[model samples]
Target: MNAELVEQYRLLHERRPDYGSGASHVERIAAIIERRGVRSVLDFGCGKGALVERLRARFPEVVVDGYDPAIRGRERIPLERYQMGYEMVIANDVLEHLDAEGYGEDLLEMGRLEPRWLFFNISCRPAVNVLPNGVNCHTLVRRPEWWREVLLACFPGFIEHGSEWNERSKGWMLAMTRPLELEGRRVAIVGNAPQAMGNREDVDGFDCVVRFNNFVVGDGYEAVGTRTDVLAIPACNRAVITPRLKRFTEGVSYVLDLATAGCVQAKANHGKIRQLLPHATIV
Candidate 1:
């Protein structure tokens, strides 16, 4: 933990003492733990130890611990009390509070814990709570995509569960889980061009067959192949890709480029495709 960053939070907490009420948030988190069969959890920035108490009360069999630098003496237990390598590590409403310089360090510390699953509930908007200087408690408010980018930098292989809206709390929650590796796996990339017309047998011979944007199989199943292990789509080709995706690509691994794969007019396509493909890994 950075001493300067800790001091900053300590001062912020002194100014806005009641800024850490996350009881409703705890309920949602607990539900996830139960559904996912998570036996152990470490609440990284457990404000006031609210979630820790609730987890123990609701699920006595499960092990839960908390760490909060700001409220450690008063409401939270010290960081040293908890052991590393929890089944899940949660940092609810915490990332947005860090200073610019401390953000990467904080994320690194969370990564060092080496949890199987990591949950982050970050407030992208301004907080209701204000400091003595009249600044919002959320100092590092950013768009969901920006947060995802920062997270990917720290954990590249992890599978992301994109920003999902919580109707109960009216907030967004982001999650990522460590994925099983596929080392030296043979995969055939089948494009939508005419060359892939009669190569079904060769394509299907591989362990997995990957299809490119807006591909068809029903027309020539014998020639084009029926199996689609993965779908690779460019960011700007949404008009041709969106409807096909909804109709066919459930449970399919989608590989998408963040920018225009080939060429597009607009610098940024402010369309529904961006929201639809939120969890896509940037190529």
Candidate 2:
């Protein structure tokens, strides 16, 4: 990102309160990424520049820049005059806000940056029939498959080799592994889909193969079970967002005594999100 644009992204993050309490989501993501020896990255939707701060703290010398169209703060990057590409891209909780202008043009613009790998997270609901929760502040709730098709077509050389999704969040969390080879590659969920968590019919378990299974029933996803033959990931897609590893990450997690899952705890990892998210569990 150019210096001015980077300034704009940072500006927006300044207003939002530090919300993603706990769960080491940032570090766990960094841990999975540290293995790559990343040099530079584009932290898309870098709210408060918090995640970028964590990435910098952990990776040390890695060059990390960010962008967010919503920000208008003093410490943010404007993103208008930015001119550069990145080796890696980090865009957590960014998809739900995308328009054809953002995901389409913005990505094509970023693609020119030539990022070898992208670390992104999107809004998702469990195939387990969870809850109607998108209204919670920042989630845009797009189809997980749409993400795969766009990314795959953009970066045809890579594949999501192994990823974990927190079934409870219904959100797909993953590590997009660089593609080794993509000749007729296929992926499928190996076990029985998780039982739906509650009664919201639209909210199903994270076994996205069920999402595609909907293709056979009609246009709209009829019911989770009606679409079975389709895999959790797209035929071209090679991943399933699973949970993160708790201990494998750089820091230790802490918890509170209350039964309610929403609680905040801090860690040495250099960012606010190091605080845990309620009901957040490691895969």
Candidate 3:
């Protein structure tokens, strides 16, 4: 957030009380609260804190807090702590007003708070009001696709539950859930530890089984079951790993190469791996 831009917004909020109001997203956010059973909600970039009062009135059981750099009380919370344990975080009609350079940083900061869900309402078109400096209020107006890329980069593995472009507001409303595809399922991430020596029945009973790099299962079958639904392996040294992989290719459907960070050899290794494990998908 730019200091000068924040000062301009602060002045605007004082002059026009309805300038940063987030009443438009009240119903949308309230629906999430009711559906997800969210105990607490932190309204990121809340203007005038109007949404705070409205949400509390609607869902008295849910704790709602607002944070805005331009707002006096709200400004202090974001600066003091990054690990706010809110179940849901909402930013409505707020990203457009911020500087383009600082947008990623702001999104990353919001992610650091670690909310279970993130709700974004971004205006892709120009704002109705102008700034104190004789400029459009919507400083960074980009298409919905551009905004989606930014949000996805910050919150990886978060599945998009709902998304739609609202012609009425000339913006996009997106609801994303963190830790994708794990809800209401029995998932067992079996590790290659000595403690996992006598739990084959319990391990294989899970709906999904995830195992890490180079897990053992021949003589050690009793310890770590024969089920390898999802195998996560390091991308390095495929030549050494191929022999072991050939031995345990059965029931292994997906192989996640985790050490592929700037390693050019990892992409080349994927082809060799595909031939070795014909049944499994190499990622």
Highest TM-score model number: 3
| CA lDDT scores, all candidates in order | 0.67, 0.46, 0.75
Clashes of each: 0, 53, 1
Tens digits of per-residue lDDT, candidate 3, 113-181, equal 788889988899998899888889999999999888888888975655568797887889888875324
Model 2 CA deviation exceeding 4 Å by range: 1-16, 19-24, 73-84, 100-102, 125-139, 180-283
Total backbone clashes of model 3?
1
Residues 1-283 of candidate 2 have per-residue lDDT tens digits of 3344334334433433553212236865665456556677777666556777777887778777766655444233334424556767767866654543445665566566666676767666322221133223332455667677777687655555344566667666544544322234332222333343222353224322212211232234244323232222222222221122222212211111212123332222112111222122212
State candidate 3's TM-score: 0.63
Error of 2 at 248 (Å): 14
Using TM-score as the yardstick, the better of models 1 and 2 is 1
Off by over 4 Å in 1: 1-5, 12-17, 74-83, 165-170, 180-283
Give the 10-residue window scoring lowest on summed lDDT in candidate 3.
Answer: 272-281
Rank list by TM-score: 3, 1, 2
Worst 10 residues of 2 by lDDT: 269-278
For model 1, state the Cα shift of residue 40 in Å. Answer: 1.4
